[model samples]
Target: MSLKSIAAKLFAGVIYKKTQKWATNPVETQQRVFEGLIRKAATTSFGNDHNFGSIKNHSDFVSRVPIRDYEALKPYVDQVIKGDENILWPGKPLYFAKTSGTTSGAKYIPLTKESMPYHIEAARDAILHYIHETGNADFADGKMIFLQGSPELEEKNGIKLGRLSGIVAHFVPAYLQRNRLPSLKTNCIEDWETKVDAIVEETIDQDMTVISGIPSWVQMYFEKLKARSGKTVGNLFPNFNLFIYGGVNYEPYRAMFEKLIGRKVDSIELFPASEGFFAYQDSQKDKGMLLLLNSGIFYEFVKADEFFSENPKRYTIGEVELGVNYALIISTNAGLWAYNIGDTVQFTSLKPYRVIVSGRIKHFISAFGEHVIGKEVEQALRDAMEDSDAVVTEFTVAPQINPSADLPYHEWLIEFEQEPNDLAAFSNAIDASMRKQNVYYDDLITGKVLRKLVVTPVPKGGFERYMKAVGKLGGQNKLPRLSNDRTIADQL
Candidate 1:
């Protein structure tokens, strides 16, 4: 056997054994992971102050540390930014994963020597587990293109700061680096258009097997490739089989990808955020991702409806009920204590503890009591596009709470690459889809309290212009699919 094939087989075997153990008894696995995290962080100042050493079980830990979001943990993160040792983690973090901040211009999430493995190894095993399940070993034999942020990391207070994908690039296995593209020089180019141009030039003739990145940016790459080569993706890269994606719901983009490639390829979805690697799609037949219970992170869930309440009841892994929407709470080796990452999820399976990402807490609309979320809106749009033979390049939804006209409505700003022949029919299809998905919206329409959703076809490049103005044009920065207010709508 080839060296790569041999390595793939052995790696997959080991990961399968580990996953089998956790699948058999996730409760036991989670308890062990929780205790290990506590023991590891107990010596740190944040942990010591919270009395982590005295915490013997889940209840004790929960009673001591209150749930917090980015704003609440900013003080400690500030200390870490100033090179304070043992502030959150055991020591000064090696780097900080900079993300779009709500209050500030950016959020610097700590990445330590201890916590880095969770990001790197989990990503590796995500691919390994897929190979094990499908008996696909030939993927490693060809090149893999990872569309990511600038590989050039910025320095602050003697620590590195950059996108998480760029930081993870430094840890790519030496052997695998040989099969990865584009060159470090090309990746470091900050401008998205320039970077995509460079990538197309560098990889046009390569024998590619895997492509990984956020869906939007990757779509840009695929489009550029098609424009340059005058061929479908399946024809250009005959060996290409795996497309690994995350950072946004892929449902809206799925149809576009299938149309672009001319044939469907294998896909794996992951839940890797700036905070940590949480879960990955382990089985193609399974609808939800298998929660990474043993990845040096302790999981907690708070009912999404109660997340903003004064005292939201927190549930451990064993306590979470299937099919209920919950905002995730996490404590990790990175020393983030009981932090809420803002994304909401619903447990689909309790036996192996799998979950479907429902939406973001801030990316929901209840302006008129419809309580519509990102997932529903994306699905509705996808169904509408499918029925009308239209394709959306980018889109966002915002509630127009006060209209100069008689009724308020939800407005969708869509940039379509292929516009539908019958625009009104397409709009009506979307309205019907939304009514089917949301009972509250249907009721409001029936009662004449709210008008049907308004679809505005923005000229090409409109969404891109908006993202560029916000300085988040590419690399893990996606347009929030839904908004509760008109801030985004006004800007668009």
Candidate 2:
């Protein structure tokens, strides 16, 4: 066997067994991870202040360290930025992962030595698990291209600042680097469009077998590849077998991606954020991703419906119920304690602790008390385009709370690559689908409390232009799908 195949098999043998044990005893694994993180960081300022030494279990830890978001964590992060050691994690962080800042201004997330491995290892385990189940290991012999951010980092104080993917790119092992595409020089190109062109030029003739990236950017690369090669992705790279994606759901982009590739490829969905590497899709038949219980991160869940309450109930992995949407809270080895990552998820399987990312806590439309979410909007769009020729390149929805003349409504700005033959019918189809999916929306429409959802067809490349203008055109930069106010709507 080749070196690549041997490494993959050896890696899979270990992680697959760990995953099975994790599935069988997730509670034990989580408890051990949480206690270990607490004990390891007990000497840090935040940990000392929170009395980590006195904390015995999850309940004690929860009581000691109150939940916080970015704003509350900024002071400690600021100290780290100023070259303070042991401010959060032990010693100083190597780099700070800058968020896309689509909803707000850019925020810097710290990455420590203890935590960086989780990001890299989670990705490896995702692919390893796929191989374990499917017996498809031949792809390891060929190259894999990861569409990530620039590897060149900027130093702030003593810490570096760059995208998470860019930060991780620096640590690609020597063995894997040989089979990875896009030379190190090309990866340092700051501009996303320019970098993609360079990547296409570099990898056009390589023996590539695996592709990993956010769906939208990968789609852009595929389009450019097709344009140059005059063939589908499958024809261009016949050995391609795996497509690993995250950051956004692949449902809306499924049809377009299938068309670009010209064949169905095995896919694995991962739930990774600036806060932590959380979960990944393990089974093709299973819809939800298996939560990583031993990834040096402690998981907590606050019921989504009660998240805004004065005292929201928090549940651990041992307490979470299947089918309920819960806002995710995480405490990590990187010194984040009960940090709300602003993402919501629903448990689909309790046995293995599988979850589906429901939506963002802040990215929801409830202006008129009708709660609509990213999932609903995506599903509504999927249903709307099922019978039509419409293909969405990008979209965002916002509330028109007080229009000059018309009643209050949700305005949808959709950029379509292929327009539907009947535009009015497409609009009606979207309106009908929303009503069918959401009873509250249906009730509001029936009572004439809100006008029909307004559909505005944006010119091709409108959203991409907007992202580029905002300096967020590349890795992990996702457009917010829903907003409670007219901020997004007016901007569009």
Candidate 3:
């Protein structure tokens, strides 16, 4: 083994042991994080406003600080944008992770000097955990590519601003610098298709072993490589054994990926965002990512079903239960206090606090009171695709509240890479799966309040074309698995 690989294995061992210390005492670790966040930020303007100084415990904290989404938090963010210091966190934020907002135009999530390291650390530890568990550090000796956004940043009020992935690019560990691929110039190319072409040209002959990105963007790169080289990804890069992905569930894309790569490869699922790095898949055998309790964030959860109700009770990490979907709320060293990041997650293992991203809090179909979520839809699709010839590239579900000839129903806009022999049968299978999972949907169907779902097959590259048209073709952008309205459905 190379010196770097040997050192990596050693480091992975050390990191794994350290992680186990906190993972084993998850609730206690979270309490420490909570206290630390509150203590550290107590003197800030937000803290003063929220009575952080007088807060004695979780109850006090929750009572004082109401959960605020980006819109509600914008006044403070606006102050920070105008060069205000000691508003959110102490002093100034190091950078602003610029993200696309739904109602708001642009959200500038603060990345403080204190909190930024955790983002880099969480990503690194995920790899380390993989290395430690599998005893495979050989990938460290080969080229690694993270298909991501431009590293370029814009200056605003003395703080750098860019996509979170772009900001993270600047923090790649020095040891891995030589192995990282897609030249900085290529990455800076504004157009995604052009950037993928550039990336393919750059990494085609390299010894690529580790590839990371949102699955959809990585799929684009993989497809590009297949087209150019006329070889399966596995054949092209024989050592490419580890695929790291986040932002969306990989199960939906697994079949397509297996076909493209021509084999099954080990994969890691990460739960990362601009707000914080919450969790990462710690074991290949496990179903969920291990929640990072010792990270510089305090977590709170409101049951997903009751999230919209007046004064929904927020539960601490200690109080959450397995199998119950909860809208994740967080307070962090980055100065977000009781911030609702809009993601819903379910605990799969509470012994060490492991969770699976269930859905977006706002991204759901409830037009007819059938509150179908992203996880359910994704699961339904996966169930339908199993033991079938269907291979989906991408899909989204939206309620069809009105129809020309039948009762309203769910419309599944799907872009299939390989269509099944019987479209009606495939649609029926999806509907059945959906009905099995969601009782409300099943009731609606059985009572004739709604018809079975209709599948609208999007033409080849239709979703890509739609994304490009909407100016969100690449990087961390992903299609919502399901939406309440037909905004995306109408466009598709």
Candidate 4:
């Protein structure tokens, strides 16, 4: 690490210690930090004084602002990308983070210099704490690994410059590149699929220092591991370091991952988005961590309440009692006031602000009264595969709609890396896991309402239908995981 980079890390650590202490004092103490950002944003050129909502100074604002989905913010992002000088804060717009939504086309979210610090700082703090908690002087002692993200930046002219991924690739120390995701042979120029394949091949022989990426993509590579080695973690990549991943719940992937590697996958739950760097893992073994970006936004928590409450406004982080489930809403340093990305979570601790992801509001199923959530369903799938040493290469779950029957149910279509005997046992284990891991599904099973779940295997690359449908047939592209409808189920 450069003296400058080391100093950057230390500064972030100092900020974290202060924030961690503040988290312990009660949510009220955070009012100053959270309110400070809102006020700072207001005074900036982006605030549009005539349009500042529900807030004058930080104190003048409501405890929480109404949460809005990305569709609601499309106009603002569109304006900024179109060079609406007045829409942006008083700074050179760094670049826009590209994001996609189910209903909306690509969203280009403008990120300003002021908000960029929060993203950079959160990333720096997470690494420092991971090193501290794991006592892994690896970065300090030697090489480190990072599952590199996209390698290029999108430009309006034929080519502009590095996008976020290309920038990260550039920032990495030269020494680390020799070691970065050792399996990936290509340099930055390789496209996503080629890079992913090289990464998969490399893991077989090398000692992975650190690993990162979305859980779904990570699992896809695990199949390659199975094909080349025909061995578990002990047989290949035994000297592997910790795995830092997010973008989706890791709980569902636990069983297959553990079985394939036969090792503990130390995780750093990351809440990174193209829009912003939201949160990171504070401890090596912890499931969740303190969100240090409070300086970047006003945080809101929407508790699970009666559907369509007479008072439409939901709970705030201030009013949240510990152990309550809430979806996060944020007003960013970029001048996005009150945005909700549809993620649901539960507070595990008040101090240090620990949380466990519940599921997405749009990503669940209530048919058959299963109320099966994306995270829970994922967990059940993993647990079911625990005892069976099946080599599953790809899989997708969808809610089964039985028009003639009274209720819907869950179904999984999987493509295996290696076939397994005892199909009955495998299917049974999956059933038991679903009923045991998910209470909602268990209730339905007990009531004899939902159909007995079933697992069917497809040929290799069978799940590619959705990928082709979306024109992202290879590489970083994947089918929408854990869908609520039969569009996915019927495809099988």
Candidate 5:
């Protein structure tokens, strides 16, 4: 280890001890945090923003404004980027987190300094809580490898700046970020280029004690790691104690990766987007993680039974019900009130407030999670089709999860300008694409639920019909993947 890393670890040891002492008294720690949250609210402009200042009456707020969807808060995000100090916590506006939406180009979400801490705290607490629960306490003892997006931050005057992901590395406990991946080629940003080869080369020998990243990305890395390095990730990071994932469903890839690792690597699901880290898996091997940054977020939930046009009943942390798949709504410390993040979730139970990610209310694919959405599915199709030597001229996948005797699937109706000669290989390539893009789909294939993603070839002019009918295709948005299924992406 470098001298800087060793010294930082020594200092972290002190901080970790203090944190341990504080964590033992959960009630006291939270009460102080609660007080801090209150002070944070009371001193500022919650009342002006109609944000939760002192949710003295949770029921009162519940009755006043029902739960909201992402559209409900786009105006607030607008206010945030405008540098509304009272709302966005008074600072220079950082880069907006670009997220996909049905109605617009990537949503450039404003990330404020005040609210960004919540994401970091959630990530830290998830690891810490995992250690405490697992009886392996002192989470900082081992190396943690995060397959995070590389910095897209712009640099000027020898200083780099960017979004939440960039900020995450910029603020990483100092000991962690500088540790190179042992290979010259390391992590590449999630973009058009493939950095899998480089990362696989670097990581095969390292003792990566903890691994964190999106399930799909991790799965892809695992595949590349095994192929390029002649070692499974399990053999590579044999000392790894945890595999924390965010961004997508991990259950499908669970058995695959776990088997490769030789033992069940502890997994934690983190609910984080470009906007924030909303929740995390609390207990190791358990289904859910306790919400870490509750103090930073003014919590609210939209009852699934409630209609969007109707007011959404908001909830405080105390009022949140467990086990029901209610949509998560939040107003954070930095600024955002009654915001709908578009991601949907339901609680597995209450008391400790364990929850599950139901799915994106906006993003969906219904035929048993074969429901693909937006560019993700399209890219998969492109990769698969091209790889299979089947050139796709136009295609559209619609939710066909409805009851059908033949088969229920997120049906992909394709219109090829020229029918590829190798039809069977093309079909197999599409299957491979789906499997790779969604590990859950791969699990289903291996588990033998459905044969493959049902692809029905349409005429060459199929997507043109959609574009002509809708007047546009994929600039801001496209057709819905899940509408009537109500499973969101969770059914997969």
Candidate 6:
């Protein structure tokens, strides 16, 4: 083994032990994080406005601060944008993670110096944990590619602004810098298609052992590699064993990935966002990611079923229950107070505070009162795929409220790498899985309020073309798994 691989294995042990200290005492660790966040930001303008000074406990804090999405928090964010110090956090933010917003044009999520390290640390520890568990740190000695956004940043009001992935590129640990691939110039290319081509050209023959990115984008790179080299990914990069992904569930893409790579490889799922690094898959054997309670963020959860009701009760880490979907709200050292990042999660393991991202709070189908969520749809499709030979590249679900010949139903727009032999049977299988999981959908189908879901086949590359047309071709952008309306469905 190389010296770096030896050091990585040794370091992984140390990090794993440190993580256990907090992971074992989830409630106490979260309490410390909560108190620290409130105490540190108590003098900021937001704190003063919200009576943060007199907040003695979680109850007091809850009564004083209401959960605010980006739109509600914009006034304070505007002040920060105009170079106002002490408006949100104590002073200026280190950088703004620019992200696409629906109602708002672009959201600038603040990344402060205090909170930035945790993001880097969470990602690093995820890998180290894998190394420690499997005793396979040899990937550290080979080239690794993190397919991501441009490292280039634009200066705004003395603060740098760019995609979160782009901003993080500047902070790659010096030790791994030499192993990271896709030259900076190639990464800076504006177009994703062109960038992937460039990346393929650059790393087609390199000793690639680890690859990381959103699965869809990584699939694109893999497809291009297969076309150019005429070899499966595993054959091309024999050392490649670890695949790291986030932003979307990988189960839907697993079959396609296995076919492309020609083998099964170990993978890690990360729950990261511009707001904060919330969790990472701590064990390959476990079902969910371990929530980072000691990170510089205080978490709150509101039951998803009651989230839209007036004054939904928010539960802290100590109060959440397993298997209940909850809208994740957070307050952080980055100065977001009681901010709803619009994600829903369910606790899979309360003993260690592990969670799975269930869905987006707004991204669901409930046109006919059948509130089908992302997790359900993804799970239903995955179950169907497991029972068949369908190789789906991408898919999305939207309610079809009106039809020319039949009762309204759910429309599944799917792009397939390889189609199933019997499309009707496959669709029935998906519908059956969905009905089993969601009682509302089952009732709707039985009562003839809504018909069984219809699978509308999208031509290969159709979704990619749609994304390019919408000017959100790549780099951390994820297609919503399901939507209430036919906006995406009609376009597809």
Worst 10 residues of 3 by lDDT: 397-406
Residue by residue across 107-149, what tens digits does model 5's lDDT show?
A: 5566666666767766776665555555453334455666655
Give the per-residue Cα lDDT of candidate 6 at 183: 91
Clashes of each: 0, 0, 0, 4, 15, 0
Q: Compared with the true structure, what per-residue lDDT tens digits does model 2 show for residues 91-164?
A: 98878998755344678899888899999888888888888888788898888899988888899987888988
Taking all chains together, the TM-score of candidate 5 against the true structure is: 0.64
Off by over 4 Å in 3: none
Clashing pairs in 2: none
The TM-score between candidate 2 and the true structure equals 0.95
Ten residues in sequence with the least summed lDDT for candidate 2:
99-108
Q: Which candidate's lDDT is highest? A: 6
- Candidates, ranked, TM-score: 6, 3, 1, 2, 4, 5
Each candidate structure's TM-score, on Cα atoms with residue i matched to residue i, is 0.96, 0.95, 0.99, 0.81, 0.64, 0.99
**Which runs in model 1 stand beyond 4 Å of their true positions?**
none
Tens digits of lDDT, candidate 3, 296-410:
9999999999999999999998888889989999999999989999999999998888999999999999998999999999998998898589999999999888788879989
CA lDDT of every candidate: 0.88, 0.87, 0.93, 0.62, 0.56, 0.94
Better of 1 and 4 by lDDT: 1
Error of 2 at 260 (Å): 1.5
Candidates 2 and 3: which is better by TM-score? 3
- Per-residue lDDT of 1-492 in model 4, one digit per residue for the tens? 555346545655675576667567645655665666655555444454434445655434433334457787666656666665546454436666665556787766666767666666566567667755554544433334555455556674222333454444545655345655543235353555566667666566766556666666666666567777787754576655566676667765665677777888566787766556766778655666566535566676666433235434555555667755566776666666667767777776655677766677666676655666666666666776667677665677776676466565677787776666887688778888777866878888778677667787888777655566656643334455567777776766
- Candidate 3, residue 297: the lDDT equals 90
Comparing 4 and 6 on lDDT, the stronger one: 6
